[model samples]
Target chain A: MATTENGPGALEPRPAPPKEQRFSLNAIQELEEIASHYPERKAACLPALWIAQREYGGYLTPAAIQEVADRLGMSYAEVEGVATFYTMYNLRPRGRHHLEVCTCLTCAVMGAYDVVHELERALGIEVGGTTRDGEFTLSEVECLDYCGAATVVQVGDRYFTHVTADNVLNLIEELRQSEEYTPVKLADAIVKLHLPGSSQTGGGSRTGEQIRNNELY
Target chain B: MGIRNLLFEHRDVENIQDIAVYEKHGGYRGLKKAVKMERSAVIEEIKTSGLRGRGGAGFPTGIKWSGIPQNDDKPHYIICNADEGEPGTYKDRELMLKLPHLLVEGMIIAGYALRGTAGYIYIRGEYVEPAWQVRKAIDQAYRAGYLGKNILGVKGFNFDLYIHMGAGSYECGEESALMSSLMGERGQPRLKFPHAPYPTVEGVWKSPTLINNVETFCAAAKILDMGGAEYARLGTERSKGTKIFSVSGHVARPANYEVEMGTPLMELIEAAGGVVGGALKAVIPGGSSVQIVRAEDCPRVNLDYESCQQNGTLLGSGGFMVFNDRTDIVLLMKRTAEFYMHESCGKCTPCREGTRWIYKILDRITSGGGQPGDVELLLDICSQIDGRSYCGLGDAAAWPIVGAIKAFREEFDYWIAHKRSPVGPGHVPPTPEVVNPLLTLVPA
Candidate 1:
């Protein structure tokens, strides 16, 4: 599947999904609310898809694309065209855990190439290729623009920087072994900033006081 | 650091922002010279010199000038794109704040070269001081007979200048979107096809117009004065002339450096204080949209468009952001993705939906939601958004998310597996609010 260098595959672009499959009622209501922010319905496509992709998983199943189109009052083709154009909208099923490596110039210069190769070796899949166990899929992408730190990778919503091949290998093994890990609370994570007047000091510290604790915001 | 002398030698009587100070420093000399030359000669000179646009695209400025229809009947508009919104980008603001007349002079030269009578400088609203400086300069120019009607006794070529403000949309940085905003419409990009049309043939009001970046216009005066060959000698073969790079991130000195194109990257880092005493992890050679270059990748990379393209990154606006050893790729993804998601114009589906989808995947992965198949899912989503969006914004928005995953998968794997950042997550960093809402609050 990855034999081709780049560009579209041999198959013609697929027809858009049917109207009913575009979205569910629950998502439609939310999209309508997002549409209110912009005068043009087209402008809501991004925000709507953000919510829709969350509801539909990694890929924008044909039905999900159609639903976004229907909600935005745009044609299925327009919606499909947009979905297929960007690298973010997934068109296929993916593993339960996704890993993003920053190959932007900065990361690449910082031995990101080796990090990518390490993941491929660990998962037995090429960049942009999925693993047989559906546990990890890896791909190369542009800069995350966190030039303050290189060798950065994003897993889920969190960012990990200053990474190496060894760091990645161990991390992958830990993830595969740990089934009890759960997401940290956003509010708790956010509260660790220790605002000047705020009373919370050690009240909400999660584990290691990291970037979330720094009040860059 | 006090007025680099080349651009400020004569203009340092006081501050260039004031008309009196600028006039004392031979401010309108370029305009004066420009008024005497035929428009054809000015355009020819620029084209021959091979000066390119300074606003990242690096398209030859003279060719753009020549693209305008010479015999067009419609009124031509000339605009200066001053909406410098790229994060880690601030060179335009520095130019405007220190050398307002340089910009005005550049605009005059560009207007003459393009035969435009009506011109505007679209200033970003957030930059109040620079906007004020430009406004003052234009008023000064009008008073000194540099703008409006015939200038310096040049007959039949009248010029008028105006200042237009943008409503804080990064999309406006795109040329088409900038045109839409200039026309009082929402700042959304239009379809670009065929040979990039000369703006003068079909620009603002569907008439012939020439829209140039602030830096591009400013470079015009210098290029005309030096001639094309002299100007070409400064930069590399393909990328001619000096480029103003906005240096930021983990460095001792985070300021703008105007250097000849193709200068080595390691030199820039060293000049900026050599990574601030920490491990040099990565470097963003261009604005946030360009691919990130890892520290090891910096040896051969030069600060020019051709070099960047050859190296798989781009010299996008020269907005360099540096990262150190402490930075987390996942945090970078979330922050950048969140920015794209917030700023997404929702014009096309790929960018609109794709941005958010990646953000969610990154969010879940970083938040300790380690599913077995998450990585494959992420790669698949990125492939869908790569070339499918309607505008570059979609591609711009998606690059950081996908790139982070590509270069730093292990960090992500660690977060998913450990339920904490692989670097040791405790609390998320707080984002800074640059604009003060309280400043707008008036006492009752």
Candidate 2:
């Protein structure tokens, strides 16, 4: 048998066997209802992945992908291809808070890189790394499309706007104290947005009052 | 002209997102009117309005709506492309967030005009907050009989609207890629006209589908509410009605301004309280994909489609980004390149590979490794990628760099010769520390 290489592209350790089905009864129901909206079952693959991401706690493990594929009656490879294609879907576990800093054109000219550098210094992690304490994961994102508020940072479902190098650390301090806007919460919010009456049921971090009040940024 | 509120006429109304409040402001009167008129007559009103698409391409909205075969029993579908991912654009986000019922009314109107089955609003996944408002609006519409069977009590006229959220892919903003993603595939562009049939002919499970931008749909609603001729009277001769410009970056008041089509570009800057922080350096009249015009040339440009083309740029998606004197043009181009590189769907080779080359070259120039011929090399690479790819992403990737070079060749030359920005240190996007230390170990 050929020996495995030790560096990049090396494959040595085998993955553990797939875990038990993680989709809860509620998740299954949500998946079926969303699927009914589409003409074909395959059309539910994206929403099914969202349900999987929430059920698997914010990241899509192999088992999670398998469950989505099985539920949608899609090949695992087809489902995995979609899971990896999207930037929002987490393939690996992330820190509780995922701080996506917009560093696109307008934000770049508005000192977004400075905010990224500040977050990197404050958290002691590079762009893609999670904090050792598991509090935050910092990554520079392309435009979050809220260029009116340059240097927009998205955590969970909420977009914190007008973030500057001067104020980013303060925002970090605030995020540190808050339990809302976590990755799981982001997934939960997304999954709920697809379901009807989710607004009245008070899904996601924003309350019906906040949405009604036009307080959302 | 200054701000002319058509779609935003009732924007400041309290609880506008609520169905009762929206109806109080004369919402859904368009759907009610559209449902009463003959379907052909409804499309005729849209054609009379001369509304072009607001989603970058300035295609006539009325023409696009009329493209679907009439009296078809093939289960027509309507898609509202709400995946607003253009860098400097956020008008759709605001529309969906503040006026969710407006969009719902627009789609319902289109469903009535197109004799549609159901409508799906393909909103980007990050817009969970906006999507919630839309979901609530759809539910409320259903309850009010504004949606579902015999909408507004029109017998045999049925329409259902649903929200389909994209999972963070900018390519999905493109209509075909959006349809593909809706069918639960990887978000990549399919072949366009001449190679493949139009989405209106065969889309979403091979059923006849009509896909339009969120703004286009909203404008349709307004067109029906006001008679089409009245709506057409506001804008330029060609680009009709008002366009919402998301003005940001170095402006004192960064917000969306809905102005008539032929407004002076500089007046828009003035409308946004003029340039702040420093004197205006340049303006990306459209989103990042369109060409940038220097401040000296901005006076000649108008915020209309044809006038923008005359000035060598486009009124794309109305992402009006302004930059100031402290900004470095070369560094800005590099960051722009980085965005296209990251967002390229990789289905086509020119976009997939050319975007990376552009980023690497721009990165090299900014990192003190630019050779004498690097600028020429950048232009040549851009030329290869501009029109050779499967979709506009490649062309979009190529335009700004070419436009930047055409407008500011000296800046690129100065950076190449001095191995630093001509605008000097302390640029807005300062040179970042090498995130991957290993990249530094590579020989320049």
* Candidate 1 fraction of reference contacts recovered: 0.01
C-alpha DockQ for predicted model 1: 0.02
Which candidate number maximizes DockQ? 2
- Report the lDDT tens digits of candidate 2 across residue range A1-217: 2324566677756553375698999988999889999999999999898888888888998999988888888888899899989988898888889988888888888878788888888899988888999889887777899888888999988899889889888888888899664888878777788787777777543444565564644
The candidate maximizing TM-score is 2
User: Model 1 - which docking category?
Assistant: incorrect
Candidate 2 regions with alpha-carbon error over 4 angstroms: A1-19, A204-217, B434-444
lDDT tens readout by residue for model 1, B1-444: 111224434433445566666666656666777667788988887887787887767788888888887776767778899877665566787677667788888888877777776777776544444555566567667777788787778877787776655534677778888877665455677776554554557777677778788888877877666676787777677887777777766777766677777888888877777686468877877787777777888888988888888877888887887887766767666656755765566788888888888777776766567677777787787788887876677778767666667667787777777766665522222111221112211110
What's the TM-score of every candidate structure?
0.64, 0.95
The numbered model that scores best in lDDT is 2
DockQ of each: 0.02, 0.51
Fnat, one value per model: 0.01, 0.69
**What C-alpha lDDT do the candidate models reach, one value each?**
0.65, 0.88
TM-score chain B for all models: 0.91, 0.98
